[model samples]
Target: MNNQDFPERTCLICKDKKDKKDLFRLVKTGEDKYAFDEKQKEQSRGYYICKSHECLKRLSKHKKIKVDTDDLIKMLNLLKKGEKDYLNILRAMKNSQTLSFGMNMVLEEIEHTHFLVLAEDISEKNERKLLLRAKELNITYVYCGNKQQLGEIFGKDEVSVIGVKNKQIARGLIN
Candidate 1:
């Protein structure tokens, strides 16, 4: 299927239509209970919201949702758990041996890499080189966390860049 084949949903706060996969979903599980559906597969009444802080803030103040402040905050926290989710994905890729790290290793294996994850604190020279190579190869890249944070995922003291080898995992990370 192509991009146009994906279903669209409207954000409750902004009332703007967007691809379902591009929005965050919140499902009503009970009369007054709501849960964040990170995977967007919950079997309940689901509400779509734009994946932006502005929409989140607007939703929190929405009077029609009937949710108390505390419950709304808890549900919002669940949506903000993306950092943990990203780390878990990295760990899974590491265990599956589908990840390459370090500047030299990633550059050497660039041909096989599906995606690039660079540290926010990466040196200017290294970032320029990796970005240039990625652009030439048409490989998608993203910046996340700092060197120390990314390095911890690979049991190293520091890592400025990581290359994901699995196409499906890379697509998922980008989305």
Candidate 2:
């Protein structure tokens, strides 16, 4: 899809127009009450905010939102927790045997790989090789966590890379 195909919304704090999916939607559940709509499916009055720390912090000062500082902190924490939920997704992929971890295994099944998740601290040599392969295959890739954190998901001592074969899961992870 082209850029025009995506709907846009203005951030209440920054007043910057951004793709709808790129902003966080806060729904007004009741009088002076708001809730984070993670799926953006809430049926009610909604406000959009940029998914950035600066914009989020400035949101508390918006007179229309009527959110307290403490509430803003809670919302920030909720957003963070949502990001960390990717670990659970990874675990599900592992259980379903749709994930390949470690350098050798992933390279062996590179043709079947839909997405690549590399450790933040991956060795420059392996990182460069994996990125080069991913570029050649046109596969989406991201740097997440350290080797130890990623390894814990697969019950390993350490893992520098992971390849996901499920197309749907890969798209979700990259998005």
Candidate 3:
């Protein structure tokens, strides 16, 4: 949606008006209980905070409101978990003889691909083709992280595509 169509929300900490979707939301569900509304679909009195961690910390300290720091930590942990899991999958691939790297190499054996991981920085044309082929073959594909990170896992300066030939490890990465 355009900027005009988006609902504007003022951050309680930063006092800056921003699109509702661009800020974090806290919904008051019970007497003094507040829950972080990531989906912004909660039905209750809600307050907006900037997406910044600093703003979240400030809001958490507000009087009359009880916010668990663990909730914030948990959210961060969940994000970190994805990267960690992907890295672990790459590590396992490094040791296996079935792992394939490079767009050309992956596309060569796309028919038997178990899991396809593509870096976000990959070219649009290549990304679209690989994703489409993966879909046609019913292979699980994940578009995640940056080229540098993916490359680091493969001991390269940058990598755009990786194919896991091991079904068990591929399933683990997809799950």
CA lDDT, every model vs. true structure: 0.80, 0.81, 0.75
Compose the digit string of candidate 3's lDDT tens values, residues 1-175. 6755768988867799977755668887677667777776777766876655455566667776666777677544544566677777687669677788888888998877799888867899989899789878988776666788888887889889889888887877766
lDDT: worst 10-residue window of model 2: 62-71
Question: Which 10-residue window in model 3 sums to the lowest lDDT?
Answer: 74-83
**Candidate that beats the other on TM-score, 1 or 2, i.e. the better one:** 2
- Please report how far candidate 1 places residue 80 from its true position, in Å: 6.5
Better of 2 and 3 by lDDT: 2
lDDT by residue for model 2 over 1-175, one digit each (tens)?
7755868888877898977866788888667666677677878867888766567767766666766566577767865665468666887678888899999999999999999988868999999999899999999886666798789998999999999998888988878
Q: What are the models' TM-scores?
A: 0.56, 0.57, 0.58
- Could you tell which candidate, 1 or 3, scores higher by lDDT? 1
Ranking by TM-score: 3, 2, 1
Give the lDDT of residue 99 in candidate 2: 93
Pairs that collide in candidate 3 are none
Top model by TM-score, which number? 3
Candidate 2 local Cα displacement, residue 71, angstroms: 14
lDDT of 1 by residue, 1-175 (tens): 6745767889887898987765778887666455667676778777888765557777777766544566457655754576557777897778787899999999999999999988868999999999999999999886666798789988999999999988988999998
Clashes of 3: 0
